[model samples]
Target: MSLMTTLMLAGGLLLLNGAAAPAETRVDLALVLAVDASFSMEPDEQDLQRHGFAEAFQSPEVHRAIRQGMLGRIAVIYVEWAGAFDQEIIVPWTVIEQPADGPAFAERLLRNPVHRMGYTSISGVIDFGIQQLRHSGLQADRQVIDISGDGANNTGRTVTLARDEALAHDVTINGLPIMLKRPSSLWDIEDLDLYFRDCVIGGPGAFLVPVREKAQFVEAIKAKIIREITDRSNPRSLIQPAHDALPTNCLAGELRRHQPTAR
Candidate 1:
């Protein structure tokens, strides 16, 4: 064979071999980090929330948890949500398989500008998170939606409806109720943690890490992420559990809006 022909055949073989190799990476879990960006959050609060996540992803504890996973890796995506139609994917799906991947994930998180808009639609973001999991491409033993919000669902169809849908699909939903202070508006509920426990989170191993103070945001987020990465079943061990069987008005947000205010 001529020299040129021999080289061409070798190159073609190499290309074919590369194409046949599997490109997908397996992980222990697939997580969607859904942050609430409703108008209730002040600009500084938004920044604090974003930074808290960034710091958590960079923390040694979280990285350690990732490495301890069965596959030693996990796929995560960051999303910001507001009204029923205002869900945005801040960071696309990324796999973290090593310590180095943690900082890279943190960098991407901090580089993006935090957005705030519309009303608080917990149901909308849960639906969006489910969609993301379906299209993540990465195979995982566990699928989770880490939803953090300060208020109740006021604009969406219903939070319970969405939560049930996700649970039915075998996707676990965890909550981070930001109850740093009193309800900002009538639509906001005083028992945000109870709302999360009874209505927002579902599926096996579902739990919440409530942030009751601004100073606790970072530590709370870090602990939550670690627990998630490790697939811990009992989150109450990490944080205080909400009151059991507490009556929560899931439709409180809508009710307040429709009812006439007493003069």
Candidate 2:
């Protein structure tokens, strides 16, 4: 080959190789805010849920937590899900390093329109979260799936299966069980927090914060995000240890949704 042609071919190969190897962003944590938008979550409750997450990102404590991380940065994605096949990415992976980035992230979350879909599928969201974490073009020291929902896994495969799979992949699962209203629906189960602790959350530092009232949304979300970001596993957050007997039926939602009179 001519010298000029050889140099051009070499440059072409270099460009092709570089194109095939995409750069990945490194951060302290990769957090998937997997929210629920099931039909059971009333419109007002959905509003509170969105506001809570938005305000949590805008909080001083959360900002401080992110800043204090070893890398001083974290990657986050917001997702909403319902049913086994219903999942939407409200916000793609974004890095938050400075104080301003927090609000910017919050703004992105708040700007999106809220959604309410049929059925609740905790397992679906968990599996979706795992996919996002693995494919997210970001390298992180930790990965977490934050689940906030009012109902249980009615339309998906077993919740524990998904939880265990994520744990096996070194991903922690956290919970914010919204219990503002009484468990009046067939899909709603009493002791939702216990359900989350025993069946949903697991990993090295897994914990859950139950939201029992409307007033606690913002603060509860803020505290949970801080704990996840700081990697502080407070046993107090869990109602009981993981090895203990399941406090509530892990399949209660599935059962209730299928057989309304089983309870």
Model 2: lDDT equals 0.82
Off by over 4 Å in 2: 1-22, 238-247, 260-263
Top candidate (lDDT): 2
Worst 10 residues of 1 by lDDT: 12-21
TM-score for each predicted model, relative to the true structure: 0.86, 0.87
Candidate 1 ranges beyond 4 A from true positions = 1-24, 235-246, 260-263
Task: Candidate 1: give the clashing pairs.
Answer: none
| lDDT tens digits by residue: candidate 2, 30-56 | 899999898888888888889988998
* Local distance difference test, candidate 1: 0.80
